[model samples]
Target: MPRFGSWLLAVCFFVSGGAFAGTTCPNFFIAGSAPTLDASLLSRTTEVCHTEYVLFASGVTKGPLYSAEHLTAAQIAGANSISRSGSWHQETGIPTADRSQSSDYTNSGYDRGHMTPAGDASTLTSEGETFSMANVVPQLHKLNAGEWEKIENYVRNIATQQGEVYVVTGPAFDPTTIPTIGKDNVAVPAYTWKAVYEPGVGAAAFLCTNADNYTCAVVSVDDVKTMSGVDPFPALSATMKSNPIGLTLP
Candidate 1:
C-alpha cells in the first residue's frame, strides 16, 4: 500500500448538470465525477463540501442523500489522533427549509447518524464539520452503533491497507412510507449503505437495514444504485458495477 500526504480542500459544492461545481475538489470523486441521482429523486438537492468529505443533502428528505470521501492511509493515520466532537448542528450553507436542525433529532427515537463518520476526519475542525446535520440521517439505534459502526471501521481499515479508497455513503428511503421524525419531520431511512472502491481492485457495497433486525450484507454497486436511486461510481465499468467483490462483514 502507498501513502500520500494528508491535506484538505475546504469548499462549498452544488450540482451543475450532474457534476460538482465544475471541477472543484475533483479528487473527492473517482475519475473526477460525482454520483447522479435517479430523476425521480433529484429534487431540491444540495451539495455541501467540507474539509474531509462532501455531502449531498436532500431538501425533501431532510437529510443527506449521500456523502463522498477519498481516504488515504496517511489521512486515516492522521484522523486516528483527532478527538470526537459530540456537537451536531445545522448546515447553514443549505437553504433553511432544506436542512435539518439538531433540535429536529431531539428525542426523535432515532440517532443522528453520520453519513461521513467523524472517525475519518483528520483534524479537529473537520471532525466538528462531520457532525453537521446535513451529513446525517435518522438511523436506527441498533444499526447505528452495531453493524453500521463495524462497517465504518472496516472501511477505515481498508483505507489503511489499500493506501487509499473512494467511499460513498448514504441512506435509502421507501418513497411511499417516508417515515419522519421531530418537529422538522426529518425523514427516517429504511436502510443505510456504504460503497468502497479500491483503485486497481474492484468495488462493493454494504447495505444494512435500519430496523430492529439490523441485518447487513455485501451487495453489488448496481444493487445499491437501484435501491438508493444514486449511481455512486458513474465512471466505474459496467462489469465492476454489476459484480460485487467479496468483503468480510462484522
Candidate 2:
C-alpha cells in the first residue's frame, strides 16, 4: 500500500486549484487514464464540475485527468438533455472516446451516467453538478441503467444512513479492455468498481462486471480483509480520495 504521505501528495495535486487551470475537486486522485485531449485547448476552459470523480477546466469539456477518444467539445456541449441539467449536470461531461466505433455509440450513449445517482444529491446542487459528461464514461446502457443503477441507489441509502460518506467511482483501464461497443452498436464493459469510505463509520467497496453476471461483491475497506465469493478489482497501491466540499446531502 502507498504510504499516507504519498497519498496526501496525490490528493494535494488534484485539489491544488491551479494545477487544473483554476478548476479543482476538494480532494482529487487519478481513478485511471484513458485517451487524452489537447491540454492547451482544455486549459482555456473555466467550467468546473464539482464531483467526487473527475474535475474539469473552464472551457474544457473534460477534466485533465480523463482521456478523450472520438468525442469533441461541440458534441458534448450540444448533447445536453433536459433529464440532466442544473445541479444534476455539474461534473457530468468528463471526456471519453468512443473506441467502440458503434454507429449508435455516439457521445450520448456515454451520457454522464451517475455513479452516485441524482437522488443521492437531492440535498445539494453540487451533487447534481456531478452528473455532467465530464464525470461520465462510455458505459453500456444495460449496466448503466440496470444493475449498476441499483448499486448506486444502495450506496446513496448507505450515505443517508451514515450522515456523510466519501464515494469514488470510475472505469478500470487495462490492455485487454472489454469491447465497449459491438459492431452493431451494443455497449459493454469487462468490469466496474465503486469504493465507499465513511471514515469512522465503516469503509467498503464493491466490484461487479458483465462477465460476473452483474453480481456485486462488497468488500470491507476498514481492513485489508477480503470477501468470499466476491471477485476483487485490480487493487491500487494508493487509496483514492476526493474533496468533500459541496457534498452535503439534504
TM-score of each: 0.90, 0.47
- Cα displacement (angstroms), candidate 1, residue 28, comes to 0.6
Report the C-alpha displacement of residue 212, candidate 1, in angstroms: 1.6
Candidate 1, clashing residue pairs?
none
Error of 2 at 205 (Å): 0.7
Q: What is the lDDT of residue 128 in candidate 1?
A: 91
lDDT tens digits, residue span 123-210, model 2 = 2444455445444445656767776777766655555566554555534322233344324332333345565655454345554554
Number of clashing pairs per prediction, in order:
0, 25
Go through the candidates in order and give each one's C-alpha lDDT. 0.82, 0.37
Question: Residues 153-189, candidate 1, lDDT per residue (tens digit)?
Answer: 9999999999999999998876557778877788888
